[model samples]
Target chain A: MFLKNRNIWLLAPAVLLIGICFLFPVSWLLQRSVSEPVWGLQNYITIFSKTIYLGVLWNTVAIAGVTTLLCALIGFPVAYSMAHSSPWIRKVLIFSVLIPFWTSILVRSFAWLVILQRGGILNDFLAGIGLIAEPLDLVYNRFGVLLGMVQVLLPFMVFPLFSVITRIDGSYFSAATNLGATPIRAFFRVYLPLCLPGLATGAMLVFIISLGYFITPALLGGRGDIMIAQLIFERIDEFGDWPLASALAIVLLVGTGLLFVLVNALIKIRGRGI
Target chain B: MTKTTPKGGLNRRTFLKTSLCASASLAALSIGTRGAFAAVDLSGREMVFASWGGSYQAAQETAYCNPFTKATGATVIQDGPMNGSKLRTMVEGGQPIWDVVDVTDTFLAANEELFEDLDFNIVDASPLDQAYVHAKGIGCIIWSYNIAFNTDVVGENAPQSWADVFDVEKFPGKRALRDRAYPMLEIALMADGVAPEDLYPLDVDRAFAKLDTIKDHVIWYTSNSAAQQLFVDGEVGTGVLLNGRTFDVNKKGAPVDLTWNQNIRSIDYLVIPKGAPNAEVAQHFMNATVDADNQALMANTLAYAPCNPAAFAGVEESVLPWLATTPENAEKGFLIDAEYWRDNLAALTERWTEWKLT
Candidate 1:
């Protein structure tokens, strides 16, 4: 009856589009990962076994994890301010957070370079103020990579937390305090738990997106900052080794998928217990 | 895709007048040259020419494509910003959109099977140096990664060799190095006191060891544009950069300059993709690229060295010092062994990644 329902026809276009655009390509990628250079899991084996690939995979996960953590730490405060601030201040805060989305990521990365390079504006200002004798090495390091990524991804975390924080009644905080809880304890117990859904969503968004980041890290990062995406690109672009690139892609996809599922399960379990 | 012409008579008239003037000048250039492509009647024929875009490709359009178009009456539709994988895919799919493509020596060497063999009957490779000539492609330009530095930063103490670049204690600043396995390995070996000729089958371990010596002091760049930025910004006192890129920044009054000493020469070859539709016309266009005057124009514009030796005669006196193929400069550098790279690029690149992590 559900299949025969006329409303089911409304879903046809979306299903066809996803099947054509997403599923087909993913299946093709999956097929290539196993099929090319002989039919087996040799490509995956190489990726896992090789120190080069394993190192990059670790770098990718580590960078993404750090970026997600930074986003959550920074976003929590900003989202709180947006939720609690005056109407005009909220608008200004929201606008400022979303401003980065307007500009291209490449432009933003280059802007960071201009601001953070040894001879760049930030160094000149710092040196002018006699803060230090020499310009600090800022860009072209892990710091620069994380700075660039977090700037671009801040809104992703902020907006979700803002939406969730806005819905959370302030009376719950007052009630917890009235029940003889300390302000910090009340905020942590009542406020933090309420923010979990948003924090989880934001962290997942930032981490997964940051995992596939190519330009920001490539432009800003140093020698050791190579990510899995860069490796995949090199394999495809330089070597034209599609099989290996495909295997790398599948690995990233599967890893991200597993993360999504694990987080969802944890969230569901927590929801039932509460 | 057919380009839509503007639907206005006055604009069309101006366009015709401009093209006619261009054709007239091109005709005069052909007449004055010895190796200029003889006018061929290829009316109504068109072909795609692809290269790495920006000023370099613009100069190529002026040097190679314009003359070919004018001489043959064949429309040359410029395309790309060439991508290795995209080109390979097109060829493997058996319907390459590019009739002609400009690729690095390493790429051409590695993917030789993906290219159509040059039609010797159509492409007269005589005027060009035999060494630059290949069965699969024609060497369009010879450029090199030279020891480059900021004149303002390094002052009178320009780095003379890769060894000088590696000696950070002597130079005392960050140095920009190309972030690739090929020439970096060669440069490191040469820096480690290995002779240029003995550099091949690279002592990989020795190269990595040598690279480790200055790894802290180095700013590795993946692109020449980034390398130029490093030099111009004085972020690097001395390092390695392409001869042409150094010339570009120097010409722009960036106080950046390069030494031809111990330069690592590499080439860009123009090749036809395996299933290019206009293979015949692409072969004819190769003649235009080999012409002494065209090569000279390219060298004058970009400071990329001409493959045809005779082209040097027409090159500007000032431009000569910047060219990688100048007799003196050519002697100072050795061409990177692309064949060796073809076999080792993938494996060594992985090793390079591993080395960089360490």
Candidate 2:
């Protein structure tokens, strides 16, 4: 009994750190949501009732979902290649993926702005090549925002998926191949199922991070792309509406929490099926 | 892992005692140094002065902060690009950190409870423009949002008015505007031919309709620096920019030209946060900052106009036209109605968000 309970005690420091740093502040914010400016749930009501707020919330969710989907589609093949490649090639690929991580997000966003704006490098290149008569509107819109977000978030997806893919025994593929299955068949039956946990994890990480994104979208995207984070920032910075901002934040928190739970439940059901 | 026995006849307990003694002595040494440091006669008081950063803060440091520190012997710590929410949070948490903040008059007017009432005696209101001096704040800088264009792109046919900014057919390029709703609406109204004197109780519907015409050609800049960068990079042919930003870029020989026609002028104020840790020292700092010579120095450095009328005495004649507060420049531009905005900003902001999304 003593030994069994000792492991629980080992978790105390981590739990205490989280309580002091994250949970305490969050709880205070939650309390403020319902208490400030005459003390009621009016802030939440206003958020729910306002079409603009709801539109922003929907826009945030849509952008996150799309970014996650794109990351999964793009990152899976790259991560798989990295996992199966020669050691030297794998190292090069890994270094390339991580090089972006070392660059500041602001710098990356501004770089994208330079490359995509009118009369910018991309436009100059295209014009020089006689590809078009006019410069393309490649930035300050949804396309620019997506490009920036995917660039910033791609490595997040790749690293997790790569770690998981590398852990799978190489023998599983050999065994499947020996059982008269084609490479594609082996991948679908043996490899794809094995990649699920990492896929889900990478998707979840990308999605959650994208949901709270402020700078990339603000800098690159059009007015239509104003996310929840920007709205919350403006509420506090421009309007001094803390209660409303808190209420909006709580809504985002609860929504993200619900998503996490839903994803975990789906994973569990998939596990049972396997 | 097996625990290694201590060497040199020093056990764990003895080592711990020695280390503890060493740390205690180190702390005592630090305290002694701090005491010696306090001998400069500021009563060991320090105050935080919050302002927008970059060259602006650097100029303030040289023009205002250093002078204040020299005169009063009080330690002044510089902080921020002022954040309204952080100030609100600090005040709400009952541990206000910033002693004084530089903020727009609109912001100070909106968040009155976050600041302490200014005592005229302490703040020395004599040098300041009486129109800008308030119960809760003293004017720090008066600036304008004017029509600024890249001369290399626009050349001799540079946009001279807000209407030209809205006329993409004539200009034939992207135009940048601030992301905020404030001066945009005012500019839109002006572009639509509303005279300056007849501008308020603003025709919001008309402004939105006029804005719709150029919405496709518009790119929104989130900050002054971003706007300046856009101009310097030639990403936008013209933009509605703060006078200081255009001045900085032009000073750097960026071919950015400023036009004061239909410019919207506003005042930024310096105020002490409610329950600031060093409110008394903050008052002294404020008084020093508003001195005519300091204001002129700040104006010369940043090209934003000084709040003190007497500052003009110190400004060079050639630089006067560039300033927002010059009688000629001020006469050409319209004053932003802070009182009207104080009442209608929230509603307009909501509509502005919806319009942007659409």
Q: How high is each candidate's interface RMSD, in Å? A: 0.8, 1.2
Docking class of 1: medium
- Model 1 stretches astray by more than 4 angstroms: A1-6, B1-22, B26-36
Clashing pairs in 2: none
Kindly list the per-residue Cα lDDT of model 2 for residues B229-300, writing each as its tens digit. 889988889989888888888878898989989889998888999999998788777776666656767787
How do the predictions measure up, each by TM-score?
Answer: 0.95, 0.89
Candidate 2 off by > 4 Å: A1-4, A169-186, B1-46
- DockQ of predicted model 1: 0.72
Q: Please provide, for model 1 over A164-250, each residue's C-alpha lDDT reduced to its tens digit, 9 standing for 90 to 100.
A: 999999999999999999999998888898899999999999999999999888889998999999999999999999999999999
Taking all chains together, the TM-score of candidate 2 against the true structure is 0.89
Best candidate (score: lDDT): 1
| lDDT for each residue of candidate 1 in B1-358, tens digit (9 for 90 to 100) | 1111222112333344346445534422531252324446787999999999999999999988887776678899999989999999999999899999999999999999999999898888888888899899999999999999898988887889889999977899799988889789999999999999898888999999999999989888887777788899999999888888888889899998888889988999999999899998999999889887788889889999998876776678899999999999999999899999999998899899999898
Q: Which candidate is the best by TM-score?
A: 1
